[model samples]
Target: MIPWVHIDTGTIPNGGGTLRLMRRGQEFSIQLGQNELMNSRLSGSEVALAELACGRIAARSGARVLIGGLGMGFTLRAALQTLPERALVEVAELVPSVAAWARGPLAEVFGGILDDPRVRLLQTDVAAPIGAARAVYDAILLDVDNGPDGLTHPGNDRLYDHGGLGLARRALRPGGVLAVWSAHPDAAFTRRLRDAGFTVEEVPVRANGRRGGARHRIWLAARPDGAR
Candidate 1:
């Protein structure tokens, strides 16, 4: 058996826990404490998060997408595949080292997707961009801190709160989608989305595509046509 080897460690930014990178033969993993945040082998649900959202706005021209986290580029690659050639995908990664890991030890996993013209990677909190404009993005996707309570950064709760949800609502154009990925289900959040004026749909997807693995949740919330 090939034993797991610790490759590197990085701070999660904003006083979050330490992020450790590990490798066992061909597979790689990024973890915080005992929670495995991401692994090279399990990317199905993450990809689904982008496919479900971008699939909705694929036909639109000049589409813009804001992705809150850049974990191994699975979601970003899926978004790139789903959207049109002219679309723009902005990935806001709270930790700078996460981006560096994407380019360094994890480069093969990304397949050079970061070099795509449609992508703009930023090393900062996602909230700034989400609140920077009104009705700008065609969709806003959040994979931050595993469904909003902050496994890494405590402030991530704001993104799921009424105010943060409102900010996401305000940042999106009418009919835009807000897709969020979570490790587990949270029913209260569904209600919050409803109160925030988004038509919400929660999807259950497997971790390793159709092959079968742990299940994950994805919430697709759509801004109303009449919403500002």
Candidate 2:
């Protein structure tokens, strides 16, 4: 067995805690403290996050997407694959080092997706773009902070709260989708999505997809057409 190597470490902005990058041969992992946030070998759910959301808006001409986290570029790469040539994707990553890791230690895992013509990487909190936009995005895909129940950043809770859901609803174009990836299910959060006026679907997927791994949940919340 190849022993894991500690490649690098980065501090999360706004006192979010520290992230450690680890590798064992070709396998890579990004972790916060004892919790592993992402791994190269387990990209199935992350891929689903993009495929499921992009599938919802595939018919929209020149679709625009906002991805809340840039971990390993699984969702971005999947989104680029699923979206049309004219589509544009904006990826917001709050931690600077995560972006750097994508370019540096995890470059092979990212496969140069950062330089894609449709990709625009924003090194800031995803909330900044969500709050600034109005019916701007065709889809907003959030794989941030272990879903609504965050572990690394306390501030990430706002993205799952009532007001945060409201902002997301406003930022999305009518009929657009807000897809969120979670390590676990939150029935209350599902209720919140309904209360926020979104047509919600809770999907249970394996971390490793068909091969089977830990069960995870993805919420596909669609902003109804003509919704304010």
Candidate 3:
């Protein structure tokens, strides 16, 4: 059997962990430790989540979208293709090394989209934009840290909490959509979305185009019209 080569990427300040890119022949994986974060193996669900998020907000002009995490740029690219010319996308990525990899080694995965005019890639946490903004974005799509139940960073757990959900609610326009991609479903989290004053719905998605394989869940939440 061929060995998987490990390449040192860099480190994250907040997490106090080193980033490594592992490659074995045609397959590539991103890992913070023993746990695998994302891979090139399956991305159909990611694409579908992007589409679902955009569909709810594409009706409006001058749409402002915030994409949490820029994994391989599949979500961003799909959004760019769906949104109008007047639309803008701000992608917040916590790890600078992941951004570097997208632009440097894994450029082919996104076809030089790191430099796309529609995309504003920030090397910061997604919570920053979510907290700082004031009812600006029409859509906020988050695929960070697997899901509400899965915590990649101890701090990321807050993003699923009431406070973080409140921040996300404040950052979005009235009737705006909050779409989250998860590896699986969490009923408790769905209830939390409703408690946050959002109309929540769960959609099961597969990671195959016509031919299905692994299944994932996408949670769609819409802020109330009177929600501030």
lDDT of 3 by residue, 1-228 (tens): 878888657676576577688887776778877867678777788888889999888878989999998877888988987888888899998888888888776777779876767788888888899999989999999987777843656677878999899899999999899999988889999989999889998999987745797788999999888877
Across residues 134-169, which tens digit of lDDT does each residue of candidate 2 receive? 999999999987878667788888999999999999
lDDT at 193 for candidate 1?
A: 95
What's the TM-score of each model vs. the native? 0.98, 0.98, 0.94
Ranked by TM-score, top first: 2, 1, 3
RMSD of each: 0.8, 0.7, 1.6
Off by over 4 Å in 3: none
Q: Model 2 lDDT vs. the true structure?
A: 0.93
Error of 2 at 29 (Å): 0.6
Model 2 spans with C-alpha error above 4 angstroms: none
TM-score of decoy 2: 0.98
Alpha-carbon lDDT, every model: 0.92, 0.93, 0.84
lDDT comparison, 2 vs 3, better candidate: 2
Backbone clash total for model 1 is: 0
